[model samples]
Target chain A: MSDIVFTNVARNFRRDGKEFPALRDINLSVRDKEFLAIVGPSGCGKTTCLRMAAGLEFPTSGTVAVGGVRVTRPGPDRAVVFQQFALFPWKTVAENIGFGLVANGVAAAERARRVADVLKLMNLAGYESAFPHQLSGGMQQRVAIARAYVLDPQVLLMDEPFGALDAQTRVVMQEELVRLARVNPRTVLFITHAVEEAVYLADRVVVMSRRPGTIREIIDVASVRAADSWDRFEKIEDVMDQASFVHLRTHIWRLLREQQAPDDH
Target chain B: MSRRTVVGIATLLAVAGLWYLLTAATGWVGSARFPNPAEFGTAVKQIVTGGYAGARIHEHVLQSCKLVAMGFLVAVSVGLPLGLLMGWNRRAEALINPVFLIIRPIPPLAWIPLAIVWLGLGDGAKIMVIFFAAFVPSVINTHAGIRNIEPFLIEAARMLGVRGPRFVFGVLLPAAAPLIFTGLRLSLQASWTTLVAAELVGALLGLGYVLNAAAQDIFPAMILTGMVFVALSGAASTWLLGRLEQRVTRWRTA
Candidate 1:
């Protein structure tokens, strides 16, 4: 079953009392356990698509459903990791990660156990007591991802999760995400402006046109992932040097760059 | 001790030495303008032993402190929740802000006449005055604190299945805690100032009454001692509040 499905989805934003079309009749489905990334230039409403699935925003026209049911509001079945690492600053890392469990009425012992497990899974075992400000950007994002993962959500919506990190840290985080995916697979709808990140991480990369964002093309880049390629590659940056990776990245970049050009009459 | 603490203490001492040099040793700046160090010490001992305006130093200090506490507590109890509710709900803000804005700018001491008529010349009147002083900052800061939070933090909390009153208390309250503490700190300061002002007008026994009595007698040293006690009490409470703020917002990076 496809965990997330956006069928004929359209979103219009009201700005200064005028209705501006953001996403135009988008049709996409993030298959169960599949990692689907949407890449586009800024203002393309790629995030709007993710927000629809996460139930943060409802489509103006069409239905965005999960597990065959309409997603009317945010639920425990779907978890979102924001670009800003939107952690509760007053909470310790463990408490921040365990917030969802607490909200769901998990017992204290069970919440603690799950938090500790996720902390270890995220390679943040030693930093349980550390606050969000105390950690590096990469570590904070790790906690954010772990926070989402601990809920065991069927669908994980990541909106430019590595966008705030330094270039080196971003590369490292991408690999870490891939590592987590291998160990525990979940349906992930990733949104980003980076074409290369979309190619390296997503099973299928959805290339979107500029606002009134339409799906220009959906490229299948999963074939590029050799069975042992993730394990063999020391860094996600190493995958960028390969010919197949280069070609796919360039093709998506061209589609995005072409959208920036003046339209025909 | 940390260099910062050492430097702060040294600065205070240097200012004290300057005061002593100018007033007592050099005889520059008349004693009438400011009391000498010896006269200030004698005033302190006199208040401690002989009493000031019929009450001992500790009695005056305790009375002032009690009034401040009552006023501050009442202000916080009313202001903080109102501010948080105003911040969280648009309808609440619309309903309450108009009335709050009308009351906000009026000086707390301006209520003394109304307070006297309403509650009489007891602790109630003094507390009412202090309450107004502390109330404004508590509301303004608490509202601003909730409003100024990163929108994504709210979004993130909702996305994690936190909603309704659970979201407000669990997420919004603690999320805005840094600024709420800032509000509380300002409220504490306002309470002390207004408490003194309230006591000055009519009280029989407070540090402010001591200041009024000293001024009546033209005793600069006694006035200085009263002023010093007010400062001491205000500073002590503020320091304690700051420590609580530090513990609550320990996640904040220095």
Candidate 2:
């Protein structure tokens, strides 16, 4: 069964007495265990699409399905990792990770075990009792990832998960997420504005047009791999050289610029 | 000793020295109104031994504390849940907000006559006055605390399978606790002030009653003693609440 399917989805928002369309006629299917990234300009509704899939927002029209079931609301089956590292300030690192388990009424012992496992995986084993404020930005994001992972969701929805991090930390988190996806092959719908992040993590990158967002192109990066001696930067440059990747980026850049241009005529 | 203790002692000595100089100077204006430190000390000893009033100093202190405690308990029991409801539901806000706005403007002491009419001149009337004084701040602050939570945090929690009462208890309450504690502290102080005002009417006990009696006899030292007791009780209660706040917000400090 397909992990997630969005059929001609549309979303509109009413602001200041005007209705603005965000996403329109979007159709996509993410296969089971596939890592898909949606990349677009600032106002292109890439985050909106991920939010819909995570059940934080309902589509204005059309349907979104996960694991062959129509997603009516958020559930344990699709855990979301937000961009801002939304760890509960009052909860310790361990407690935050175990929040979903606790809410689902899992036994205390089982919850503790799962939290411990994920903490170790996220390299946050020794920081279980620390609060979010006490942790560094990168560490807090690790906690966010651990929280999502501990849920063992069939699909992971990430919205610019490392966008707030410094360059070095962002690259580190990207590699960690890659290693994580390798070990636990869950379908992921990742959203980012960064082209390098899209190329590095996604099995396929779905490029979106500017506001009233529509899919411009989808570039499959499954076969683009680094040679044995090539470093990560070289691998990224190679991926950027692919004609499909270059075309998609330039095409998206033009579309965004047009969206920003004044309507003089 | 700690710096706070050292500074406190130094301040006390300075005040005592000033009092002695003022009383020693006969031509000094309003010298009789402010007694010397020695006279104040003697008066405190007499009050402790039931020299100034029929009742000992401890009796008044205990009475005031009992009233404050009862009033604070009532305020918390009513205010916390109401605040949570208002914060959680927009409908509750629409319905209850007008009533709160109407009631909040009326001073706590204004309720004294109604409380007396309803409950008679007793502890019941005193506590009711105090409760009215404390309730408004507690509810308003608690509602603000809940409303001010980051929207993204709530969205994140919802997307993690949290909903209904579980969501409120697990995420919302913990997040809003520091702000709520602030409200509680303010309410407690307000309750103490209300208790004193209530006692001024017809109370036979409490620091307020003692202060009134001392004022009638023009005994500045006894009046000062009463004032000191009131200040001490307020400070102690506030310090206790501060400790509680620290415990609840320890996670943020981590």
lDDT scores of the candidates, listed in order = 0.90, 0.85
Candidate 2: regions farther than 4 A off: A226-265, B1-9, B25-31
Measured over the true interface residues after superposition, the C-alpha RMSD of each candidate is: 1.7, 1.3
Kindly provide the TM-score obtained by chain B of candidate 2 when compared with the true chain B.
Answer: 0.92
- Docking quality band of candidate 2, CAPRI definitions: medium
DockQ in order:
0.64, 0.74
Q: In model 2, state the lDDT of residue A148.
A: 91
Which runs of model 1 end up more than 4 angstroms from their true locations?
A: A224-238, A261-265, B1-10, B26-33, B164-166
Question: What's the lDDT for residue B59 in model 1?
Answer: 95
Error of 2 at A262 (Å): 5.2
Worst 10 residues of 1 chain B by lDDT: B245-254
Instruction: Tell me how far the alpha carbon of residue A164 in candidate 1 is from the true structure, in angstroms, after superposition.
Output: 1.3
Interface RMSD of 1: 1.7
lDDT by residue for model 2 over B36-55, one digit each (tens)?
66778888999888545558
Candidate 2 overall Cα lDDT vs. reference? 0.85
